[model samples]
Target chain A: MKTIGKDRFGKIIDKSYFPLLVVFALVTLIPVYILVKISISEPVDVLTQHPTFLIHNFTLEHWEKVLTSGRLWPAFTKSFVVATLTAIFAIFIATPASYVISRLPKKVKYIVILTLFFTRMFPNVGIALPISVKFIRWNLMDTYTGLVLAHLIEQLPFITWILVGTFEVIPVDLEKSAMIDGASRIRSLISIVIPIATPGIAVASLFVWLNSWNEFTYALYLSLSENTLPLQVYYYVNRGGFFQTATYATILTIPVALITYALQRYLKSDYLGGAIK
Target chain B: MKKFFQKYHLEILLILPLTLYIMYFTLLPVLTTINLGFINADTNVFSLENYEYLFGRDDFRKAFSNTVIISILGLIMQLTVGLILALILKKTFKGKGFFRALILTPMGVPTIVSGVALLYIFDTQGYLNELIYRVTEGLKYIGIIASSYKFIPIDWASGGIRTLFMIVFADMWKVTPIVTLLLLAGLESISLQVYEASQIDGASKWQTFKNITLPLLKPSITMTVIIRAVDLFRIFELPMILAGKNTPVIATFAFEEYRLYNNPNISGAAATILLVIIMIFVSLYLKYIDKGEGLA
Candidate 1:
């Protein structure tokens, strides 16, 4: 490596946004530092000792408490079930919707696309109340169906819209050739279209999956008997028990963080596609 | 017409479930909610009482005002910081990939997880206080911020101005990466040749950014802002979990009206009003975006 004079290097670095890099790094890292510090600290020390960037004493007691606690595991199981079911439900409903939207006439395609767009913008709170109350009245409250349906409301639009984008990019000729060879529309979608659109499907499924997993409000409102992990986490905080169990909360974040990391590339690509000209 | 219909019939069949689902969840609920808003609870008769209650109420007014303030402030914060992040990360840098990954990790973590994390930091005995104590001790040795004065204990999670600020901050943390990612994509689409041409014409960095970058970015930026605004406006769990019913967002307000207040008509009215605002924004955005793309 060639070394430049100190002043020259300084100027170059400044010009190239050394300051901005530092700011972003600080902004991003501070919360993580705070979280780690709080998580490992003893509940007694959490109050008395000033939170440090480096822990003076480390303990897994909080993690122990969270693990040994019976309620935590059940909630985690519930969240997993809800998220998985929502993903399956969303894919089932959205795949067909995406196919139809992509196959429609140009005008109809535009209309359907517009509908999806509007659905995305419409706030969940607007309908969530009625839906939850309806579920309650229908005795679907605390049921997997209710949670799955609620998640579908958010997941369906995104999955279908993103899938539509994927399908639109595919040349019509491939599917046309398949159709001409006597493959049915369903067959063409399954054998021809889906394989070609796997990347987009991956991106959309990741989004729907993450949305379903992270969903808390509707779960909290609907599942009076069965709480998802997020709802339990909320209750943990509300009940002033996070201090008693910060390690579990930190541990809880690990799976989500890992899955998110796995899905980050897809999300990045999707955002890039939508945001770019 | 027959040929057109035949060609698309299969496609339309696929759309059926989604159409039905959206109708049931989106359109039907909204219509029913609006109808619900017009009825009185005691009489179970149409009376516009719910709307009158909202219009004549202080709590409803507070909720609306607070929601707007949080949305506007949060939007501005997200855009400003997100733009900075995008601009910085657009160029070559060491650990660029690492930073990008780090930035978006929070987005995938559940909202309640984040809310829980914030509570740990902002709680009285939380990390923030610990940091404050350390800083105060250092300040005492150096002579600043009154070494003798105990820092005022303020509950950060209350729906007061401070909690609203935190809500905006949490929202920014959760979403700025997304905006940054989007804006970076927008920035990348602009050819470097255009920038070089502008530079050749003696344009400054700021000038090329303002003239070339901003105009091209308008469409993406507008869409990003509008989409995020609508989504955040409907925010339920974060505010409710973090700030509780004290902080009245439009979404949580409805939840409170129904859950805590036990007034479905009032909740329906509030939800209906919020729904109308969102629809207006969506239609306006559709119109505006189409004008730019010539889709209209």
Candidate 2:
């Protein structure tokens, strides 16, 4: 009788678990679905008293308008350039520092890591104002250099922290073996350790790019005239109609979606597990 | 000196650039903002006039309280929802990976896009209201309410509790996935042997969870709280895009002072205040979690 009761309980759980998860998944995804639906939705279908969840009249006219509108390309280019440059510069500066820090003595490593973590947690608005003010005085305002520098303030510490973790996982024996075989320390790092750390570097760089691409506070303060893609989306959100805003927002999200899709395999908990520690 | 340089030249060359860059950009700006907060913009003399002025303003006070209220409320909401989701995802089930990936997709969506998408849903003539209307109509057909009953579409962007709800809801939609991911990592780190042992000892499921899972999950919970607290304190884009001036948080308040009012002193003061609060939180986190060797 007790065994039967336990089996019944287990059976009840088994019966309910999948459906419960399905509901949760649907709730999580319905917003994105609605956004995408609205973007392709015809005006008559969406701009009404009762907008159906199902797309009754599908059209790409909004997408076409956004493409040909002349605003999309410039904003896209600026965001792309800023994000790409931020990623490249971040990886270049952070990699070596991370490698060295990963090999540092424990106490010293803790302090350095703490400093990076502290800076990473800084409020963006807190620094953005001063940086923009300084950039204005230096005549760096509205320039890609200014924006990239501002982005680096946030990305550098983050990339360094992640890369430090990445480097810690790489056995020092590989580099030591190469060094013993007459390779210099630099050569070993370059030819051996770095190759093994490529995946980590790629993930960090992609995240930096995504962050810079989506950044708005610094862009709002610094890039007054040349808006980034997020700023462009914000502009439409403030003033444009529903369809246009949806279209622009969809365009802004496309690359993010693509990158996230590419990153699905690496989105496991282990990659982000070191975030606190 | 020459011998020392020769010995560690690679290390110095590799590490100096980042150290200098961080000191110049990140550290300098923080110091400058703090400095700017105290100085009088008109006289260039150090004073508390900026703070005085900000404190005297109605909107600034509203923003200050709003920031605190939203941070606490939003943190609770996100943590609860995220914990539930994480607990559910921790269980082994079919298509678990697909569901996990799907749920986490929102993390990649930009904050601005989140605001826009949520606005699309919560706007008066938006999808949410439409959903309500359809559901109510269906219910009316089933004799659940008066046949003449009509659903009143809520203008979710309007200021006050409604706007606050929208902002917190939107934040949850975007950020809860991150908290879930972090907690899942913590959960996965716990070995299966412990659970098996608990079962062998004849502990009930709830007893095992209470005695084992909760204790082990504390670190991840602490980390998520700290991270989310910092982010929530600086809540900006959602409030700015959704309710505009009608709802003001500290970050938005700072932006308004700098841009709309051209009062950099007031803006600097607001920013400095936020920085101080965040510093307190960080220090508390360090003291609690980093009992010397955690990072190492």
Candidate 3:
């Protein structure tokens, strides 16, 4: 083997690589760091000539306003409830649909999967207008049920495809053998298959929850007076002050970041791999 | 009869719930929109007036072009930035996890938060302009680069390409992590043995990457691009928050027609056109990816 300083594999042993890494880490992180800083800093501190990157008189005034704004609690509660219900219903419906697709003939299976993907291409903002009009006529407007229904429609195909990836990996013979041993199909599915697919279920549930929580268009329409957190955030963006908006935005970000950090492991796993391939 | 049920029973039972929901909600609404688009309200008769009106509108033309431009720009930036981050993260080094976490955290930052945060930065009194003012003042001391003109701080929401660039950057900042993760997964799946063999044969790292990794990563890259493209086409919130609901994206254009104009028929026509365009692009991408898969 030729001894050269540049031939290092796996590890970036070169001295220049460290600078690159440092610059990247800073570049990638500094904007968000600035965001959090502005949220906590006093307005005067933020708007000053030097614009203190270093927090001096760190105040919770903006956060306090966001919290006591009276609109925050109702919107948060409504969003939390709707997102939770959407996640559950989406996964519940998607499980069986995915299983059916997983067992389809190979050629037909690919086509069906493509169709599912195609459904995702259109914008919710586009379809939501007519749908909202119909919803009003059907007396489904401004209700959690209406919002959840719309969210379910958006999330079901995605969750189902994810579960399809999970289901496909599971050996058919494991469930088949159980059925042969006198455990019924439903029993085998409930006891054996689902337990094995817990990781995928989590991914699907979180994805659905996050999508519904962050979704703007459908909520914009279906919820006439009842605002979701995203809608409330948009309201603040339009009319609220910089600090107040930052505070609410930061509030919106915390749980999502926590869930993402917690779920980072399974996120890199085969569930997404199944859909992309 | 029993045998037929036995063969198809589980499949039927499983798909039933999803089938019912799709029938009731997705199909029903889509057909409703199509129906709404085709009917004329003024005459109480069927006509293509809504579609013709939509096609003739200046806003529709601007919105269509804006969507296309933003999607293309966003796609190129996201793919390049994502690949660089992915490649850097692929190396084994101390503090790798910390760096990855720092870099990847943006993917979890809510979309509106990213949008709103950038808006703060780009505000007249926000940190972005403040930083520029300070930097330019610092440079003014050197008396070199500051001789041309006085540095005027920018307002990012001034309604131009600058606003588009800022919004695109915000999107890339939040989404590059996702693309990185996807590409990193693809890179990890590559066999180390191939790299080792190439190294032993006296191939350079650049050569190995070009010859081996590039070909192998084609499928993942294509998949990622197609997925991102489809997503970028329908972007709404970023523009909405940054530019106050008037970025002229087709989706938002459709929205304003309904909400501001109270013209659901015209909105329906715009949406239908969007759906058709997306469907065309989706099929083309699917075909291209499938062909790439076949070749590989």
Every candidate's DockQ is 0.44, 0.59, 0.52
Candidate 2 lDDT tens digits, A125-213? 87888888889899988899999999999888888988998999899899889999999988899999999999999998998899899
Candidate with top lDDT is: 2
- Tens digit per residue, CA lDDT, model 2, B1-296: 99999988899899999999999998888888888899999999999999999899999998988888888889889988788788789898778888888888897788889888888789898888988898899999999999999899989878788889899898889887888988888888899999998777766656666899887777777778777888898999999888788889999999989988888888889999998888787677658654433332
The collision pairs in model 1 are A100-B11
Where does model 2 exceed 4 Å of error?
A1-16, A269-274, B1-6, B284-296
Error of 3 at B221 (Å): 1.0
**Cα lDDT of model 1 by residue, A143-230, tens digit:** 8888898888878887887787778888889988999999986787789988988877776776777778888767866887777777
Better-scoring candidate (DockQ), 1 or 3: 3
Estimate the TM-score for candidate 2.
0.94
Interface RMSD per candidate (angstroms)? 4.7, 2.5, 3.1
Rank candidates, DockQ, best first. Answer: 2, 3, 1
Ranking by TM-score: 2, 3, 1
Query: How far does residue A118 in candidate 3 sit from its true spot (Å)?
Result: 1.5
